[model samples]
Target: MVHENKHVKNARYVRTVESMFACPVCRASMKVVHYQSLICSNHHTFDFAKRGYINFMNQPVNTKYSKGLFEARRKLMTEEAFFEPLSHAIASAIHAHVAKPKKTSSILDMGCGEGTLLSTICNKVSSRGIRDVIGAGSDISKAGIAMASKNYSDKVWTVADIANPPFKESQFDVILSILSPSNYAECNRLLRTGGIVVKVVPRSGYLKEIREVLFHKATKKYSNEATLERFSKHFQVAEHFRLCYTTRLNPASMKWLVQMTPLTWSLTEEKEMSLAEEISNQITVDLDVMIGISPK
Candidate 1:
């Protein structure tokens, strides 16, 4: 049986009601009725199937991310534990940055694949009683968001394009982008004046073990200085942390392991076949986590 997040089950229905309505066409005000579709005053409407998620992509999103890919990602995350350190890093950053007491904290996780990082942070916050979280997880992949919404029923999960998210201006106090593409202009529009954006990008050495096996060469592009420089163009840099951790992946996780990565797309058929045979037993896990804050 699939394990669902119980915190989602315990949340008040009112929270779910308020969280579901975001206009798909205009990204403006919407009213959700019958737990199905959200309709805006402009007459634009979006439907949420019985599984519990709404698709808000204005134009067709052309990509390889599918239901199988997201399921593989979720399975790999749960089995290989790729996000354990990442989650702690995010929670710690939030605790360190939010100095003042807040009545509620709003977090918008863009390109949130299967809701692993966001769900982990929410569980941490609830367990510690740091603050009530209005956690919203969005992705361009409708299948991904649908899976996330079903598993994390309480979160405001939507099939939203990161380049143009469906929400009002300056709504989120914290935005997260983990190992995914980001639209800085849209992110800036969605965040409050002094909100924070925590990003996790792979360093050169990240998953060196996997790269070493999967391909002949892999780039260690997008240096920290470069990232900070790019982000500084929009928001001030608050703090930087270099996070690295090593863990071993079990044999059962190897298939999902390959499916869970960008490497899946990067590797050639011959190289992928070779990599699959090389370490069918176990493999190493490596990654980096970075955080930036909005201007005060």
Candidate 2:
């Protein structure tokens, strides 16, 4: 058998994702105009890269997250089993909320840092019984999308912003925003009727150990009450699933965790350097998963 080049495999994947995408400029339906490019009626086009992802950004984004951080987070997320529980929770939520009419479901993860959560959740859901689950992830960070596409080649990955998603109307069965910001208006616009929006927010105790080590008084106490209140305004809150647990962190994992998060960025170099040794302890994973829907 002749082995297909990486670019050829990626070009084929482009066909699978065409229906979900629209021309970011004209909002027209996109087609696989070429093996390596997607084009819309208005002639707007985006090219698929050799590594199996597409860059659909209209403008450059300057974010606090860097490639190094995303790489580290991906390592902990997949190899070290950091967020397996949350992945299962997300999979279960999708299974329960997805419309019963269709056997196949399409899911999109907004602000998907390196696509770890989406990949893990979709894989789990499919493994259990739902073999027709299709998952895609998008983020403003090109570096993050690059890593995601390289590692999780099966899922469609793109570089796009949440405020203006590059997907068509009624394209997705579920939209996931895990530990990331949400644009409810855009999410509602992209979902099918009775489609689901799964938003994961951090609870008060999330990463409390790291917080305690970094700042005691000046740091704002964690809160999601305001966020939930905001979500309720845009979506009908169907369910609020909470996942709170503790996981032991070794020095290596702790180092990556600290480096991955932006919380330590504000600290002085001396404080950050001095605090590294104290992170080898149990850390809390407190999160509230909100399942919501737009007004029908």
Candidate 3:
């Protein structure tokens, strides 16, 4: 048997969902040409990387998230099962809300870091009987997308900006924003009329152990009131679920916990080392999973 490289496999998969994409430059429909490049109707083109992900941004945009951060995050999510309950909850929300007359669905994860949440949710949804599901993940961080493509080759991975996503309007049945920033308007444009958006936001107690070590008393407490208000402004919230749990981590997982979040970004090398050592073995995972239907 001839072996196909990652690029070949990804290009073939993109061909199946080619209509879901719009040229980032021309906003025209795109099709995979010669199993290598995605060419638009107006002749604009984007090539797939050898690692099986597409870079949709015309210019490079640097972010604070690095390869090491995403790697550490992947370890915590995959090895430590840090967000297992949250992933299952999101899958349940999708199964409950999304219509299944055709028995098929398309899901897009905006600001998907390392693609673990999206990939896990996809599997859970499929296990729930939605076998014909298409999963796509996008993040501004090229490093995150690269890691995602390498690990989850079955799904489409793209380095894209959430604020201005490069996709056709009303092409997705569900849009997910997991502990990441969201652009409600872009989500509205991306979802079908009756489609849903599942957004996960951190509550006050989320990562409280780490927060206590990294911040002053005033800055340690976190709130999602403003975020909920903004989400409600754009969509009619169908369901609101709060998930809270505690999980114990080993020393290596604790190290990953410190590196996986932006909360520790402000700490110096010495302070970071001290803070990592200070964090306890138990960590809290408190979150709000909101399912909203676009008013459009």
Quickly count the clashes in candidate 3.
0
> Positional deviation of 230 in candidate 3, in angstroms?
1.6
Total backbone collisions, model 1: 0
CA error at residue 200 for candidate 3, angstroms: 1.2
Ranking by TM-score: 3, 2, 1
**Which 10 successive residues of model 1 have the least lDDT summed?**
5-14
lDDT of 2 by residue, 1-296 (tens): 99876656776876866788888888998887557777888888888877767788877888878888898898888677889888888888777777675668888999898988888888877876775888889999988888888888888888888887888888888899988888888999988889889999888778878888777543366667888899999888989878999998777787778878787877665766566677646888889989998665
Q: Which lDDT tens digits does candidate 1 get at residues 55-165?
A: 777666877886776887788767666667778778878777754567677888999978877888877755555557888888888778778877887678777778767
Model 3, position 79, has a per-residue lDDT of: 96
List the pairs of residues colliding in candidate 3.
none
Computed on alpha carbons, the lDDT of every model, listed in order, comes to: 0.71, 0.82, 0.89
Model 2 TM-score relative to the real fold = 0.93
Q: Model 3, stretches more than 4 Å misplaced?
A: 216-222
For candidate 1, give the lDDT of residue 257: 66
Residue 249 alpha-carbon offset, candidate 2, angstroms:
1.0
